[model samples]
Every structure is written in structure tokens, then in C-alpha cells.
Target chain A: MKHSLSSLLLAAVLPVALVACAPSEAGTTTDGGLSGKLTLTGSSTIAPLALEIAKRFEERHPDVRIDVQTGGSSRGISDARSGLADIGMASRRLKDGEIELTAHAIAQDGVCMILHASNVVASLTDDQVRAIYLGEIENWSEVGGEDAPITVVNKAAGRATLEVFTKHFGLDEKEIQADVIVGDNEQGIKTVAGNPDSIGYVSIGTAEYSAGSDVAIKLLPANGITASTASVGSGSFPIGRPLNLVTFGEVSKLQRAYIDFCRSAEVHDLVTGLYFVPVRTAQ
Target chain B: MKVKSTDRILVWSLRAASATAGSLVLLILCFLVLESVEGITRVGAGRFLNDPGWHPSQGAESEFSLVPMIAATIASTIGAILLAGPVGVLAAVFCRFYAPPKLARAFRSIVELLAGIPSVVYGFWGLVTLVPLVRELAPPGASLLAGILVLAMMIVPTVALLAFAALKNVPPGHLEGATALGLSRWTTIVKVVFPSAASGLGVAIVLGTMRAIGETMAVLMVCGNITKVPSSLFDPVRTLTANIALELGYATQEHRAVLFVSGLALMIMIVLLVFVQERLQRRARLA
Candidate 1:
């Protein structure tokens, strides 16, 4: 009986041990000689681009594994400083206090106000947008639209879009009276598309794609500059931020290779495909 | 002697399995308390009570209040229960008493199947279908009412299945006695069977409430997730679980710890609710 019980326990534990040890042995050998793993963490805006770049990089090297994680730009800075990740992706330029890290611009993404296609209000001045977000202008008629209460959709804290939107509008994040708070660009677009009275700001790339498609949303021009990938590439868009690959200090040979590949023209199609303007053309 | 040894081994293994299950809850509680210490001490407990808003990313100006979120959670859960309880019970009663045998079985299976559906699917359905329908009636359809309705739908199966079981537990002898006394079918179900199954039905409602309160994905997707006390059913609100789900992905340092504090608050609320339900059940049993 004791023998049978001991064997039963061993049978249960053996498979789990084998599964845990399988990943280390799975690295393929190739002539490229890069066999180490890299972890890049940070801004959700840059994560998709990073994932694509990582995928291509892995195909070339075969032995290199890249893991990309998204937690917002602040997490990118902190994780880079703490050595938790080999590289970090931040959608904004490095702030003054974060000068210790070096940034490599991979792409540019613009933030644009989005409203349901049914909204008659075409464009909003900076002040009008600020006033609407601050709850001073409650009704759409107050902003040259219908006589319905405007629903202000704000991004949740820690999202790069929220930081960029707030900084550009000069509105304090806390002071904005938001009716709905969405997490991602897709969610924001969905919310605005679902409600005619709702207004939200999301990635220009995402909004343009959705608008071009059958989605019932339209991008509002920011500060008289047309909110489009063309304006962003021409550097005429005022509310644009660089999608950066950040490193804390001296990088490893493999990390440098991956970062350079991300900035290179090889991944330009991937960048444009996701609606983000490639840094080479933007510059 | 070999059979005796086998029985001993079987009993010991069962005891070990139960012990592991019991200790895991304690381990989680300890971990939550340990993690939330920094948030509670640095952010100060008073802020959770005094402030009405949540702004975790504002550096020194950050407020760590859980009031609005807790109120939202409680309000939504209660609202969902109020909507789901009677309808679920009645549906179960219909399946048991009124429906044809084949139809009753089919209906019961359908209700059970709803319990198997993932909450994310329900959230997606609510986001696409229900939100737009509500917007036709009230613009900005991602309001508290949408959350309540979605949650009520999600937990209806739980309440219905439990109520069905409770109803089934009513003895054959009681129905026989009611029939012998010339009581109508409705009267027998209302006056005799209902009172006997009242405690079990209460349990079902409490379980449904528990499911609604702990739900995060469905509510987060449907609810507007605004950090404010909803003034009306149409007003958007963010629940405690939704707050944690939305922000914990990027939360760090004191901010991350505060998210843990939110989690601890949820755990405490659920534990307290279960405790209250247990006490009520015991009191009812005693009476």
C-alpha cells in the first residue's frame, strides 16, 4: 500500500518537472550565434510593433527568444532602471529625470479625438476640448452640435494615451470629469462608436483604420492639423509621440542587434501596417 | 492486514488533499496582508475614507480612496441580485412544475449551459448588442444599468440551478399531504413547499450575489469604469474588481501596493458577506 502511494505521487510530479525543464532545451542552433533570451516590457502602444520586430528577429537568429510585455510607459522606465527587462518600450520621449536611459525612436503615433460618425460637430479647438473634458461644457449644443449631454470618455491611469492627451491639452488628469474610462485604443474606439454623444481620444492609427473601415467613428482634427498618418509622418501633427525602445545603460550585443533591427527599414511595412508612421519617413 | 493498510493510506491522502486546500486560502490571505502593508502605511488609511476619487498615478497628489469603487461594487451586486433572484426562482419553479417533462429537462440543460459560458463572451455580447440597444434609450449605454443587466444574466443560471435543486429536495409526502387536504397546486407550492425551501433559496441568492460581486471581466467590459459614485442607474460607475483589473497591469511601487489593498478590500468584503450569510443560515436553522 505504501509503495503504491509513493509511486502515485511520483507519477503526478514527474510530468510537471519534465514540462518545466523542456523550454531550456528547445533553443535551436543556427549560424547567427545569438542564443540568449531578451525581455522587453512597457508601453502598450509600442508592444505590437515590438512583438512584430521580435518575431522577425527570432526568425533570423533562430536561437534568440524575445518576450514583449505591456504595462504603460512609466513601467517601461522603471523596469529599465530596475534591470527587470533587457529593453523597454516607451511611446513618449524620455522625461528630464529619466535622462540616464537612451532612447531609440522606432515609430511615431498621433493621438486624435474620436466621435461617432453621426456627430455633426466636425472639429474642436484646444480650449473647447479642454472645457468639455473639464465638465464646463456639458451639452453638445454648447460646442456647436445637438442638444444632448456630451459623454466624456477618458483613458484609465497608466495608459500612455492618457498621459499624452492630458499633457497636450494642459488639463490635469484628476480634474477631468469623465463619464467613461476605457483601457485600450480599441476599447475607446468601441465605446465612442457605440454612443453618439460620446467623445474619446485614441491612437490616430487605430482611429483612421476604424474610420476607413465600416466602424461608425470619425477622427477630429487636433489644433487645425489634420489627424491622419500623413500629417503624423510630415511632422505637422501637434499631438504625436515617438514610439521608443529604451535601454538603461550599455546594452548587450544581442540587445543592440534587436534594437537596431527595430529602427531599421526592414520592419517599416510592419509599422505602416499597424497604422504607425515609420521613424525613417517621419524624420 | 493489507486491506487495513490500504484504508489508512487512502484516509491519509484525502486528509492531505483537504489540508492543502485549506492552507492555500490562509497563504493567500497572508500574502495579501504582507503586500498591502506599504500601501496602507504610506498612503494612510484615512485617505481611503476621506477622499471620494481615485487617482493613483498623480505622484504626491494621488488619492487612494476605495469608497466610490466599493459603493459601485455593492450597488451593482445588489442590483443584479434584486433583478435575478425572483426571475431565476420563478424559472426554476416553472421548469419543475408547469413545463412538460421533456421541455423541463431541455430548459434546465439550457440554464446549466449558460453557467458554462465564459464571462468574457457575455461581456463582448453586452458591449456589442446590449450597449447599443441601451444607447437607443439612453445615450452612453455603458452605464450601471448595463452592468447590472449583464451580471444578472450571468448569474441567473447559478440561482436557477440552485433553486431547482432546493425545490427538488421538497419531500413527496408533503405534496401528498397537500393533495389529500384538497389544496390547489399553486397553494401547495406557495404555502408548504416554498416555506420549506426558503432557506435553500436564500442560499442560492447569496451564492448569486457572491458570483456577481467577484465578477471582473464582464462588468469591466460593460461598466464605463468611471471612478465615481453613480447618482442614478444610468450613471456609469467603476467597481473595486474592475479598478484592480484595469490598473494593476501597469501599477508600480506604492501604486502597485495600493492595488493589492484594493484586492484585500475585495477579499474582506467577500469574507464578511459569506460570514453574514452563514450566521443567517445558522439562525434560521435554529429557529
Candidate 2:
């Protein structure tokens, strides 16, 4: 009787065993003939943009499969340095060591501060923005907005925006707190836009998209310079960053092609279309 | 006799195959250790454990400090313990003493289903709903309270189901013996059945703690990812798993090493828990 029961159990389990043992048919890429999968990691701030670019690029070059992931600026820089990333995207400037690790800059951007359309606060100096992030500036009244309590939203820890803000404010990891820590740029924009008393920051692209909304918010001028394409082009925006494409190998046939494509004047229209400050044309 | 001999060989093959399959875990551990060794040597012991600044962005002079992350891990685990313990124990007691078998089975399945949900799904829900909910409830918004609450929600079903299973496995004979002694239902559960089952319950609670400590997604979405000592439940917090997941993509030699050190901390915590549980079980057996 026990032997029969055991036999029954084996029969029940065998099909499941066979099914699980079968190899996955999904092997990274599909259609045409992409040779090897390319995995790119870094800057969550840059991930969606990277993904969008890859989606379009893959449509054009069907064989190449690209996987884009985000960690933050710190991770992007380190991934590039240690050969973990095929391409690292950062919204923050590289350290001297990181710069020494790589020679070329790929792009430039502005970190724009945004408030809701209903928010009366039109502008803030750099000091006020820093103070707000540090939990010192608590009320909208203090920043020429409403008497409502100011909700300070921020990016996830390890993100490029968070890195830049923390460095700029000189705040310790302990002192930093947000009313809510938004994990992505789109959510960050939506959160601040949805609330009249909230202040948040995102890339120039997000800020522009927000500014163009019917319930649009405006990017406050930092220091004396406005966070504008013009100001960004002329180098007056205090919240400026150099976007980079860091890779594991130097001048790989594929990487060089991609980089050259990105830097070409033809993509200038696309970059501007996305609200990013275009790469400066060679003089 | 020939058929039986063939059956015996089949069973032996099954056992051997399972053992071989299990060895794959050891293989993975070996690979992870090999990959991790280079980074570990670069990040010296002191800097990995002590540095509070997670400043890999600053370069090689700065390294990722796992301290705040470890603190977040401990806080969420402890919070889960505090929040889930009483509720889970009570559910077990209620099921044992009061619930009908039909109701009990349904409840158990529901709890199991909750446990089976993917971590990423929990994280997304936490991000969209829990973060905003906590922010509204707290003074300004992002708080350790939010992370704790989210973790508490995630871990409760796991602990309760384990506790329920442990309680149910208390031998039926023992319950009958208690009733034969003229003990009340609650008294029978508290004094007789529970005493014998206490060790299993302890094991269950510890397992629940493991779930809480290792929970990455739900806590990450709600914790606000602030790497510091939480001043209050309302302060934004960071946890070890969240930090590791958040930064592992970009961390290089030394920074990556420190992350492994953080992982080591987690391994140590789990080992210590299992060790303590065994010790207690040994003592119980001796008694």
C-alpha cells in the first residue's frame, strides 16, 4: 500500500519536474539577429530616457537588445569605472577621480525646481531651496507661497537628483528628509503638480513638461539665473549638470557608433524635443 | 520481487537527484563569494562598517556605509515583530479554540495567498498608496512610521500563517487530554496545548522576523530611503536591502565590497536567530 502511494506521488510530481526543467525560450532579444544582449545600468534619473532611446534605436537596429537600469549617479559613475555598465547616465558631475577614469562628456542639463500652478511662489534663491530640503524652510509662507505647510518631495536615495541636492545643500545623510520621497522623475513631477503647497526638483525635461501643463508649474530661478534652455546654453543656471555616457570599454565598435549617433547634430532636435539642453556645437 | 527491486532503484535515484539539485545552492554561494572577494579586499573592514556617509559619488576616498541601512533593517524587523506578534498569536489562539474547520481552512488559504504575492507587486502598491498615506498621516510625510507600517502589513500574514500551522500541529491527543481534565477551552489552549507547542511558535515568530528583516520591495517604496538614524516613526528611513538593491547596479570595487559586507551582516543575523532557536529547543527538550 505504501509503495503504491509512493508511486502515485512520483507520477504527480514528474510532470511538474519536467515542466520546470524545460529551458526558457525567452533569451533576451527577439526578431532579426541581435548578437549579444547589452545591459546598461546607472542613474534612475536617466533610465527612462535611456530606455526610450533604446526602444527607438532597437526599432532601427533590431538585432541589438538593450536593458537599461537605474541605481543613481554614484552607481553610474562607479559602474563605468569598474566595467559593470555598458553605458552610465548621470545628471550629476563626476568627481575628479571619476573624471580621471573617463575623458569625454556626452551631454548637459539643468536641474529645475518646480511648484504647482496654484502655487504663488514664483522664485527662490539657492539658499532658500537648500534650506527647504534640509527641513529648515517648513512653510510655504516663508517662500512667498500660501500659508499652507510646504510639502518637500524628493527623489529616491542614490538617484542623481538626490546626489546633486545633497551635495549642493551640504546636508548630512541624517539631516535629509522629505515630506515624501518620490522614486522617479515622472512621479516627482506629478506629486508636486497635484499639490499646491509642494516643492520638488527634476530634470530640465520633466520641468519643461510640467511647465507646459495646463495646471503647469514653473521652475524657480536659482541664484540670479533662470533655469531656461537659453540660460543653460549660456551657462548661467546654477543647477547645471553634464550628462555622460560611460561604458566599460574604450571606443568599442558598437559603443562608438552609439555615442557618435547621440552626439551628432541630427539628434540635437530630439534632445531639445525632450527638454534637455542640446550638446554645444563645435565652434 | 523484480518489480520491487526496480522500484527501490527508482527511489534511490530520486533521492540522489534531489541531493544533486540542492548542491546547486552551494555552487551559487561559491560563485558569489568569488565575485565578492576582490571588492571586499579593496574596502577595508573599518570603513565598510563605520562610515555613515554613503558617498560613493565623492570617489574612492568615500565608500558606501551600510550602517544606516543596517539600522533600517533592524528597525523594520523589530517593528514587524512588535506589530505582528500579538496579532498573529491571537489569530492562532482564536483559530485553535473558536474557529470552525471550514472558516479556519479559508482563512489559512487567504493568508497563504498573501504570502505568495510577489515582492515587486507589494513594492509598487506601497509606493503608490502607502507612501502617500503615511505622508498624509505624519507631520510632513515621509516617516519611518510609513516603512514600519508597510513592513508590518507585509509580514503579518506570514507570521500568522506559521503560527496557525504550528498551533494546529499540537497533537489532538493533548487537546483531548486537557478537556478530559475539565479545563476550559482557553485554559486548555494556554496551559496544555500552548506549552507543548511553544517551541514551534518561537520558531514561527523567528521565521516571521526573517521575512521582515529581508523584505526589500515594500519597505523600499515607503521608507523614503533616508540613510540616517530615525528620530521618530514619522521620519524617512533607509534599510539594508533597499540600499543594496538601490545601489548594487552602480557600486564598484570597494563600494560593492561594502554591500557584500552588508549582506554578511544579514547572513549573520539569520544565523544567530537560528542558533538561538536551536538553543531554546534544546533547553525545552532537556526540561
Candidate 3:
């Protein structure tokens, strides 16, 4: 028995013994924020966009590599406010009086209410949209669509898109029943497209980004007008909101360079192509 | 007729005790029933149990299956056990059989220190260290390897401490009997010491599994937060707790309900595991 126990001990220790010798990288890159390096996190909605801008800036100035991660807008703002991140990105404007980080409006984005392309819904009134999201309108036939229940697709808490959409549609303070909480834009769309009776809101940019993909979801025109930059800029789309790149009150030279590049025409062109309205230009 | 004084007091206390206990159980039951009503209604009993995909948004059919989440939870916890179980048991053995008095005391102190460290700090370390390591070693990097590795590190102290305490309780007389039988040191430990403590070790394993399954922060940091089943050692994976933490804040109605369903499943699994441990203990004693 003693020998057996000893053998068991050896069995457990062997694998762990092999793992204790984990290697560590020995070099440090000096960059813009702190003396050693800078890391940023928060907001998945803007993370991909931020990555593109960060890559462009890093190439021009190789001294700093700003690492970004996505949690959500609340996490982004909170992390930046707590000094954990050098920058925070938000698809919606920061809640009033955010003194911790100076706000920078990088671009404008709007929400498009989408359904499966097979669904016969033509458009949704602002009141009908509100009622549906508020848990008042549960069936599609009630809203002149079909005889099916409407499955709501909402963003998870802290996502900037949810915040913006809730406010734009006046669904705040009302009970909204979500069928599922999606972790990312891609997943949210996937959930909506797979269901004929589901309606979800996503950034116009995301819908644009998803263009040419075989997603069966169709964007329903809100207020009887198609959702687009032209519709939004021309006061035709009612659910338009801002896409912002926010950062601390003061930052290092490299961080500033990154910000400048975000406003450049090359990035703006990408934003326009992706269906998001670009508010900045090369000038 | 007037009750006897002792009978009156006993009856009153029983009434009070039962009311409190019964109410507590009822409240919990009510909460679970209300929380899960949508899924229970949508999928009915048989479909909810047998269906796959777990998509609450699948509409008409009412996708309430928990397959992906169950897969993730089991995968993460099992991964953690695989990572922490051996290391912890070995540490306990070293403390019990090999360490000198001062060294053992020091190890005890260190293990206690590790046990006291909060889940958030472990999560932070996982985010900083484990994620990068996983990204480097695995093809995709930020995958299950990182989550498993970090959870193992976080839970080892728990298993080690439990094993050490159990080993310490082994009767000195048993060791003496084995030694008197001319058994070697290894034989005495493996044969005599181990059998006597198997029940305690089982409890230790159960406790470690509890910590591993219920752990939120550390697992959240390294698991990569993807909802898909893991294909490789390094693919990003999401667990039940991570899903709750990530989705709870914004989830409403059915989304919130689904999160609660996952929570319910997790709680049930833990309860069943502990129950099995108790059964095993009973069997071991009976034998």
C-alpha cells in the first residue's frame, strides 16, 4: 500500500515537474505611455477598428506597440479611468461628464434593425420598434409581419452598441426580453440570421463588414427609410449614433500619432467602405 | 388540554425551526422555477434535456439546450483537475513524508498564503502570464491550454492543503505496524498510509473540483471567452461562469433567463458531485 501510494505521488508530480520550467521573454520595448510599454483594452465594437488604426500608427513609428483587447464600453472606460489602459474605445458617446478621458470622435456609426431575409416584414415604425423591444409586442403578426413570435437579439451588458440602441429607441427603463446575449458582433448576426422570427440591432459598419458574406439576415428599414450613411447624414435614418475613440486627458507622442492616423483619409475610406459614416478626413 | 412545559417549548421550537428551513428551501425553489420557466415552457421537459446547441435565440423551436455550455464547463473543470490534482497531491506528500520540521512548517505557511490569495488576483495573473504562454505554445495561443494551465495554478494550493491535512491525520501506529513488518519506507507510505487516508483524499479531490468549477476570474482571464467548442489545446474557450460574468450585466428577460439556467446547471452539478463524494465515504467506511 505504501509503495502504491508512493507510485501515485510520482504519477502526479511528473507532469507538473515538466511544467514548472516555463520560459520568460527577456527584452523590453520602451514606448509612449509608461517607461516600459503601453497596453489598452475595452470595447469589442471598436476593437477591430482600433486594431487597424493601431497597426497603421505602429508601422510609421516602430518604437511603441499598443496592445488592445475587447471587453466592452464600460470595461474600456473603467480600465482607462483606472489607469490600466492608455486608451478606451466606445461606439456610443461616453456618459455625461467623463473627465477621466478626453473624448475623441473618430467616426459615426448607427444601428440597423435586421431580420432573416425570408421574413416578410417590410419596415418597422418607431413605436412598433419600441413596443417590440420593450416586451410589449411578442408576436410578429401583431406587428403586421407574420404569425411567429419575435425573438429579440441584444448585445451583452457593457457593449456600446446596446447602450446606444437602447437610448435611440427609448427602450431604456422598459423591460426587453433577449433570447440570447451574444458575445460579439459576428455571433449576434449569426443568431439573428439563423432565425426567421428574430430581430436584432447591429452597427451599420458591422453589417457593411459582413457584406458579401452568406449571412441570411436582412436589414429592415427603420421609419420606412433604408439605413445607410446617406440616410443617416440626410436625417432619414432615425437610429444613427456616434462611434468614438476616447483616451486619457494627456498621452505620449506615440499615442497622439496613433490618434492622428485614425483621422487620416486611408482609415476614413475603410470606415466608409465598411458602412460606418466617417466624420474625419485627411485635412 | 394544557400542554406540559417541556412539550410546549419543544413544539414551539420545532414549529419555528421548520418554518425557517421550509421557507428557505421554498424561496430557492421558487427562484429557480421562475428563472427557468421560459426554457421549461419553450422546449418542454424532454426537448430541453435532449436538444443540442443551447441557443436561446433560435426562436420557434425555442433553443434552450445547454450542450455547448455543458461541454465548456466540464472541459474547463476537468482540465483544471488534470492540471492541479497531481501537483497538489505531490506537494502534500512532500510536506507529509519528506520535508524537515521547519521546511514543512514553511511549506504549510506558503500553501496557506496561496490559499488566501483572492480569485481576482489569480485572474489577473492568468490574464498577464497564462494567456501569453498559451498563445506562444499552442498554434492559436489564447486557447484551452491557457485556461487549463491557469486554473491548475489557481487550484493546486487548495488540493495540496487538503491532501496535506488528510495525510497528517494518518495514525502513527499504522506506520509503526508497517515498519515493524519490515516494510520499506516507500511501501509503508504507499500501502499503510494511503489506504487509511483514501476517504479524506476523495474529499480533497471533490473540494478541488468545486473550486475549479466555480472559479470565475482566473478562468475568465485565460479562457479566451469564445463560445465555440475547443478544437485544439490553444483555441479560445468559454465556461459557464465566464458566460455569466460576461453576459449577466446586459442580459435581459430570456438572455438573463438562459444565464440563470446555466447557473442552475452548475449548482446542480456541484451538489451531485458532493453527494457522490459523501456516498463514496459511506461505502469506504462500510467496507
Candidate 4:
């Protein structure tokens, strides 16, 4: 019996030891062949688009595998810098201090204010939007709606959407009195749709796409610039940012191919399908 | 000789398994403490526990305050216990004594199924059905009340099942003695059976509390993840568990450390609750 137990224990330990002893290399380069694994991480907003493009890329390069992970844009930048991932997908443009890495413009998206469709208020000036977020404009009637109190639905901290919004509006994140803090664009839309007196901001593409369907929400224009693909294309929207794929130092061959594929016109439909404005234009 | 050796091996293996489990808990506790020391030092432990705001940002000032989140967690848990405890205990009592055998069997199976259902499904149900219903009844549908309502429903099976088992364990002779004394059926159950099974019922409440406090997804779905000191049941608030769950995915060094601190705090809270329950049980046993 003791022998059997000892043998059983040995069996478990043997496999784990074997696994530990095995080669850890994920990619092998042989004689100018381009076949390896490429990992993309960061930006939940950019993940869906990346996944769609990765599926197509996998189909084309059958030998290559693309692993896509989403946390947020910050994770992307950090992971790329730390050599954890081949490419980092960031929804917002790189800042001045992020000079160590090179950013490839993969897509563009507009962050726009959103409210329930029942809200009569169609447009908000830059100051008015700031005031609403700052909790100065507390009532809907103050902004051309009914007599109900306005519930401010703001994004949680560290999300690229929240960063872009605060940067554009020139409001400190700490100062904005959020009544309900949502995590993602979809949550923002859902929260606003459920609460008639609530107003929030989210990705224009996502809001528009959802609004087109059954989602009872509408995009409120920012400073007279309607948040649309056309507005983003024309550079008329103030709240727009480039969705970038950042790589640290030199890009590998496979990384270069994947980035090029992402920026190519072939992925425009996919980019648009995710509600992000496609950066590639037909020549 | 072979059979004796085999028996010895089985006993040793079982002991080893138990020791591994015990050590694993100790290992986790040590790891959490070691990981959170930097964060606790950066933000003093008092401020971390007592402060009313939490803003852990990158390249920005971070204020790690769990006051509001603690308040929200406690309120929601207490509300769930208050709402679910009596109903569950009464239902278990009814099943044990009042209900017909067929009806009781059906009820038990239904409860077992409820216990088996995943928490995410419950959250989705709350999000889709309860949120909409609450919207009509109260403005801003996803509030503390909605979270409480959902948590209570989720915990009812846990409390009921445990309480039922406790009630069933009441010695049959105790019930027979009450009947022999000519006490009413209701009086006997209320007086004799309940006191005998007090420890089991206490365990049921403690387990129910733990479940409600530790729950993340369902509460996250229903509770408005607002950073505020909730004034009313209708007000939206974020719990400690929800904060950790929502932010852990994207958290960096300092932010991640603060979340770890929250985790450590939650573990300590659970341990303390267990310790207190043990003490109370001991006192009850002595009395």
C-alpha cells in the first residue's frame, strides 16, 4: 500500500518535473522562414477589432498564431515596453513621454457624450458638457430636459475612454462627480439607457451602432460636431483619438506583417464592424 | 502484510492531503501580506481602511480609501442576511414539519438546483429582469436595493439547505419528549428543536454572511459601481469585492498593490468573523 502511494506521488511529480525541464521557447526561426507566435495585449476597446483582424491574419498565415489579450491601454504600453507582448493595442494616441516606443495608427475613434433617446437635449457646448460632468448642471431641465435630477455615469479610472474624456474636457478626474461609475462603453450605454435622467459618454462608433439597433441611446454632439465616422474623418470632432499599435524599439518581421495587415484596407470592414472608424481610405 | 501496508499508506496520504490544504491557506495569507506591505506602507493602514475615497491611477496621485466600499459591503451583506435569513429558516422549518412529503421533496430539489446555478446567471437575470423592474419602481434601477434583492435570492438556498440539515439533525427523542408533555406541535418545534440546533443555525447564518460578502459578479452586475457613501438603499455604491474585480485586470504596480491590500483586508474580515463565531459557540457550549 505504501509502495502504491509513493508510486502515485511519483507519477504526479514526474509529469510536473518533465514539464519544467521542457524547452520554453515559443518561436523558432529557421532559414528565413516566418513562422512563430505573435502576442497582442491591451485596450479592451481595441481587443475585439484585434481579434477579428487576428482571425483573418491567422487564415492568411497558417503557420503563425496571434494571441490577443485585453486589459486596458495602459497594460498594452507596459507589456510592450516590458517585452511581454509583441504589440500593444492602445485606443488612445501615445503621450509625449511614451517616446521609447513607435506607434502605428491602426484606427481612429471618437469619444462622444451619450444620453437616453428620450432626452430632448440634442447638442451640448464644450463648457456645458464640462459643467454636467463637474456636477454643476445637476438637473435635466437645466440642459433642456425634464425636471428630474441628472445622474452622471462616468467611466472607472485608468480606462483610455475616461482618460481621453478628461483630457478633452480639461476636467480633473477627481473633480468629476460620478453618480454611477461604469467599466466599459457597453456598460455606459446600458446604464444610460436604463436610467432616463442619466447622461454619460462612450465610444461614438459603439453608441451609434447600438443606437442603430435596439439600444435606446443616442450620441449627443460635442461642441456642434456630431460624433460620426464622417465627422472623425473630416477632423471636425474634438473628442477623437487615434487607436494605435505600439511596438518597443525595432519591430520583428512577423510584428511588422501583422501591423501592416491591421492598417491595410483589407481590414476596413472589420474595423468598422467593431464601431471604430477605419483609418485606411480607398485610393 | 500487504493489506496492513496499504491501510497505513491510505492513512498517511489522507493526512498529507489535509496538511497540504492547511499549508496552502497559510501560504496564501503570507503571500497576500508580503505583496501588500509596500502598498500599506505607501498609504498608511488606517487611511486605507478609514478613508472615504479610492483613486489608484498611473502617473497620478492615488488615494486608497476603503471607507465607502466597506460601508457598501457591510450594508449589502446585512441587508441580504436580514432579508434571506428568516425566510430561509422558516422555509426549512416548514419543509421539515408542516409540508407534505412530496411537496418537501420538490422544494428541496428546487433549492439544490438553485444552489447549483452559477452566480453569473443570477447576475444576468438581475441585470435583465430585476434592473428593469427596479427602474419602474425606482429611478436609476441599478442601486443598492437591487443588489440586496439579488444577493438575498442568491443566498436563500445556501441558508435554507444548511438550516434544513440542522433542523433534521435535531434528536427525534427531543421532539418525542415535547409531544409526551402535551405541548402544541408549533410550540415544541419553537421551544425544543430550535434551541438544540442553535449551533447549526448559527453556522448557517455565518456561511450565508460569507457568501453574501464574498459575492462579486451578481453584486457587481446589480450594484451601481459608484464611489460614494450610500445614504439610502436606493443609492448606488461599490463594494470592496467589486472594486477589486473591476480594477484587477488592468492594474499596474501601485494600483495592483492597493487591490491586494483590499484582498488582504477581506481575508482578515472573514477570519475574524470565523474566530468570533467559534468563541460564541464555545461560550454557548459552556453555558
Candidate 1 collision pairs: none
The DockQ value obtained for model 4 is 0.43
Ranking by TM-score: 1, 4, 2, 3
Find the 10 residues in a row with the least total lDDT in model 2 chain B. B55-64
Predictions in order: lDDT: 0.89, 0.71, 0.70, 0.85
Collision count for each candidate, in order:
0, 7, 12, 2
RMSD per model, one decimal: 3.4, 6.0, 19.1, 3.3
TM-scores, all models, native as reference = 0.92, 0.76, 0.51, 0.91
**Model 3 docking grade:** incorrect
lDDT of 3 by residue, A1-283 (tens): 4444544555555457547756433223355453334565666767777787777666666666668777667667766777667776767777775865776767777788888778888888878888887778989999778787676666655467777787887775225655444556765675565556778888776765564476777777876788766776565677777666677766666556666677677687666655667774536
Candidate 2 lDDT, B1-287, residue by residue in tens: 96787687667657755765787667656655665565567766677667766665444457567677777788878987898877888887777678898997887788889888887777667655665666566544445776777677777787788778778777888989888899998888888877887877787788788888888867766676767677678777778887777666656556667667677677778779879778756754553
Pairs of residues clashing in candidate 4: A1-B6, A43-A72
Tens-digit per-residue lDDT, A1-283, candidate 4: 5577775685466558648978655432222455788888899988998999999998987888888889899999999999888899898988888999999988899998888888888887888889998889989888777888887888888899999999998999889887788887877887888777788999888888889898988888777777887798778898999999999997788888889899999998998777777885456
* Stronger candidate by lDDT (2 vs 3): 2
- The digit string of per-residue lDDT tens for model 4 on B1-287 reads 98777767666666766676798799899999998998888777887766547787845567778888888999999999999999899999999999999999999999999988999899878877887788777667778999999999989999999999989988899999999999998999889988988887887888888999999988888788987879998888899899988888878878888889989889988998898678756754653
List the TM values for chain B, per candidate: 0.95, 0.87, 0.84, 0.94
Docking class of 4: acceptable
Give the lDDT of residue B129 in candidate 4: 82
Q: Residues B1-287, candidate 1: write the lDDT tens digits.
A: 88777667666656666676788799899999999988899889898878757888888788888888998999999999999999999999999888999999999889999999999999989998888787777767888999999999999999999999888878889889999999998999999889888877888898899999999999998999988888988888999999999999888888899999999999998898798779757754653
Whichever of 1 and 3 has more lDDT, that candidate is 1
